[model samples]
Target: MTTLNLPVVVSARTKWIQLFLGLVCMASISSPQYVWTLLTRPLAEKMGVGLAELQVTFSLLIILQTFFSPFQGKLIDRFGPRRLIAIGTLLSGLSWVLASQVTNLTGLYLAYGCLGGLGTGIVYVGVVGLMVRWFPQQRGLAAGAVAAGYGMGAILTTFPVANSLAAYGLEHTLWLFGAIFSLVGLLASQGLKAPLDEVTEPASRFVAQSSRQYRSGEMLRQPLFWLMFAMMAMMSTSGLMVTSQMAIFARDFGIADVVVFGMAALPLALTLDRFTNGLTRPLFGFISDRYGREKTMFIAFALEGCAMTLWLMSRDNAVLFVLLSGVVFFGWGEIFSLFPSTLTDTFGSRHATANYGWLYMSQGIGSILGGPLAALMYQYTGGWHLVFGCAIALDFITAGLALWVLQPWRRRFMQQQA
Candidate 1:
């Protein structure tokens, strides 16, 4: 493999500044997914649609966001991050602006689902790909920090969005925040630039990483990549089920309207979940940096399973329900950090953006199973018990895969590269 000998050096301060800008950009686009739950009830009432039908929008958003990532990542890789990300932020904000005026389901899907998905997808894969290259020595920490922005950004918006929905009505609220998201994201994206190959740090010895770069096509042919994809799919299903269905299930559990800790249970739980979800990415990523990726995956996945079990058992108690939701998210959100970091470690950073983009399509598969499909399951089963049970099972199964399958396979793969 040939290496570049670029003359321009990216200073340490410049790299950190890039990371900060990436985080801000990620945060700016987060509400389209994380804040969707707050809009569901109103959207449903306005459109006169069933929950299952409404959730297809969520599925579409995720499907488009993930399914097209390879193409989007390639564009970012070739054209650089600034212009594409700026355009992405604009489209994301415009989705909401357009969604505010839509009268029917198809229009809603096009505006909020297609446009929002495409826009956020660009920013997400672009920022993550940038982080892995810029911080090869701290892939976990850097990726997690930016991923945390996506997860936790909602913390800053959840309550305000909830309040806006209550005060201004859904349409006006969408317009207001949509404009804000666009402007903020556009400004943040202006500062983002890919690191020059010569300035990037080599992989740290503390973590296992491939010595040679593998193109996306080569990565796709590897059984190891497929195994990781399956694990990520299962984990994504478990987490996204909660993400897209939490409000519905909370209501079914009779806790959505219940006041706990002097606040409405649902919004409070959502707020707390955002915080933990955001915190866990960097926290677990940092751990994986030293202890190993597979080990951290086992621990976090198992924690989510345990938390889900407890959450199901204690559903009737509003206080426990709120607290447990946070725990569940804490265990689930680190996938964004761990998987990308692990993939770069295994595949090499030269093709990191496009390779990880291919891997990210797993989230789209998860969204199909977790979003509309899970909603339909609830409709058929007439309760959330079976739905929650299935998610718990997937959680444990994925946890097992992390230790028994991924750990060994990844070790061998790295040894061969060595």
Candidate 2:
């Protein structure tokens, strides 16, 4: 039997260029999510709100970014990545710009939370979708690379933004960086275009992928898809807790302001977390490509559980706190790579963008659980220990699900498809 394939209309080099452009677009919009912690304190003070209340802004950002991604992904699939991503970057930047001028909490929510969420959501889903299509055989690595852009993109701004927040104040910093983010992302997105055709490669000897394409609605109905969604939601909660609450917990641990290796512990840890977080995506993705998605997920998720346990234990030590923060993120950030790749492998690429969008909404569910709800839990409990403990439990549980449940289920699913 012969396989019917879409003709390869673009050169191999063209896809690489497309990947690079997607990465750049991703990087340009990274600051909103990754650098959000740095703005939390100032924003809280400015709006005269409590930590739990201010965290609603973060929740809104994540909720809109993820909850609405299905629509955004569909738009990208219909209109192409270039225009939508360009608009998204501009909206993302404009969120900060408008946020800087706002005087009330509601305005902040609308500007920074809603607009920013919608914008970043578009670019994120669009880029990941584009990368998976462009590099079907190498989906894990490609998705990881662009996801790394989102995770690590703030590395370039973490220190600079910190210094700016200190030197120029929140208004000027937000305005300047907002403009920069918009211009850079817009320029980068101009070069992005989805692959017009598929180029099939020899099937991997290790990993099994679906030969038939499933549309978004059909994929959504599968028990296997819901299982992946539940798994992703747990992982997202574990990771987003660290991401959104690290600063608060660091301060509570009495290490936020402590100097560790010359820099403040909080910023230092944040910077290192960015690096490890960004590094883990492509690293684990590369491994997943050769080994298997569930195996890589198990290893990485277990590592995160161990790292979080260590991090909680070392909370009192500034040096260890800074170091272990990176380890914690290293374990958590690979979800972006593994989930989308696995989704595409199971569902096929015809509707990969929209299908992944449905899966990505799990992150929104996670953001709610991990962001404001975790903060509320901390408020109710009077400490972060309970919050951290719950997150640790989730990490191990999801890891177990991946290895024990998902692996076998996916194997059988692919077999039935065959």
- The most accurate candidate by lDDT is 1
TM-score of 1: 0.97
lDDT of 2 by residue, 1-418 (tens): 9988756555678889998898899999999999999999998888788998888899999999999999999998999888999999999999999999998889999999999999999999999998988887788999999999999999999999999999999999999999999999999999888766555555556678788999998998899999999999999998887779989888889989999898999989999999999999999998999999999999999999999999888789999999989999999999999999999999998789889999999999999999988898888999988888999999999999999999999999999999
Model 2: residue 183 alpha-carbon error in angstroms: 0.3
Cα misplacement distance, residue 385 of candidate 2 (Å): 1.0
Question: How do the residues 36-62 of candidate 1 rate in per-residue lDDT, one tens digit apiece?
Answer: 998999999999999888998999999
lDDT of each: 0.93, 0.92
Give the per-residue Cα lDDT of candidate 2 at 71: 95
Query: Please, what is the TM-score per model?
Result: 0.97, 0.97
